[model samples]
Target: MVFIQKGNNPLLAVKAFVQGIGLLGNPKLRKFVLIPVLINFLVYGVAFALGYLYLADIIDQFIPGWLQWLRWILWPLFFISFFIAGFFTFTVLANLIAAPFYGMLSAAALALLSGESATITEAPWPKVIKAELNRAAYLGSRAIPLVILSIIPGINVLAPVLWALFGAWGMALEYLAYPLENAGILFSEQRKLIGGVRWGALSFGGLAAAGLALPLINIIVAPAAVIAATIYVREIETDNAR
Candidate 1:
């Protein structure tokens, strides 16, 4: 089973992502995102209709006859706005619903390594906040470098691999570190604690990201990825102890 595969293998990262979707295996989060997205769509639709009505007379008078050609632009922009609003609403709700499961799965992943998962129970909020902060810091630090790397001559050739590799590393660290730190382990200490297991976590995250990128199938990938990471981390800790 993919679940039992060595977590450190980068080649397996994509599979891990696909497999994570299976683990989440639930329709609940889907409904959660859908409901909010629907509401946003309706709200935006109403606002658009009302605004158009209120502005109908003023628009006809102010807008030049030839400027009416801008209807092409306005129509697309209007729909695009609705699409964005729906997507944003869905994304916010998805994150909130997925956070708890992500936390638990992250904890479980660490537990596989025989690292204590207690912080999930003992100090949930602080650990969650710390993970979020670290993630923000990690991404912020890499932003400029990533932008520069994208512009390089030959380096551009290696961009995809680098993207996959770095993406996996960041995600792994974010998902796995929370549970470890919550157990009273300091953030710096995690560098050493997760030393050999970093590749494994990266592999899992890479695969998870791949799954998230898939068409239609991506809806459940978020939570599934979290659970798989949790499992992978837990297994790594177990093997490390032996």
Candidate 2:
């Protein structure tokens, strides 16, 4: 394992993300990544099929016949809204379902990074599920206000900027939770640690979010993000220990 020296660089997150992409070819980590990829593929396949089949009907229901002309204007906006909502919703659902595997993946990645033998342990499923639910609730509480802001007349202009920032921050917290939780760090403590290096965390997650929004590429992003997050958390710990 090659370790990058710690520094006060703002681009550390970018480096970590690139390194993480490189690490995906590792035989040791491939199995851990496989399951999540398969899950994503299956979930997304069904979602796309369903959306294609009913999207027209769904739009028609929302827009009355008198307002049919508005479809041209609202169609693009509807697609954007659906894509954003579906991405976040399915990401959360997929992670929740695969939480245990992610926990193991995080542990293995940490071990590999530390140049120690990879020890795959059975995660405490109940605890893992509970932790995932907690994160969902945390994201939901904040997202509700953002959703409302996005609907307002004038103030809504700033909502996109706020949502982008929040999405990046949320992505950081979401992935970082895996490794930190495996190390027995509490959720609150994980936030504080990531908050200490907010810029790097956001950069890492922003890239992850971008990858996730792309078609086909998103299948690999989940596991890569997990590994990248493991790397990020390790760096954070090393820096703080100094």
Q: Rate the local accuracy (lDDT) of all candidates.
A: 0.49, 0.77
Model 1 off-target regions past 4 Å? Answer: 1-22, 26-101, 105-127, 152-155, 178-184
**Candidate 2 — which residues are off by over 4 angstroms?**
1-10, 54-75, 152-157
Instruction: Write the residue-wise lDDT of candidate 2 on 45-79 in tens digits.
Output: 76677777876666456455676686686555545
For residue 74, what is the lDDT in candidate 1?
A: 42
Candidate 1: tens digits of C-alpha lDDT, residues 128-226: 566555555655576457545543433444445565666666556554554454445565666555545566666665665555444344455555566
Query: Ten-residue segment with the worst summed lDDT in candidate 1?
Result: 80-89
Positional deviation of 205 in candidate 1, in angstroms? Answer: 2.1
- Work out the TM-score per prediction: 0.54, 0.85
RMSD of each: 10.1, 3.7
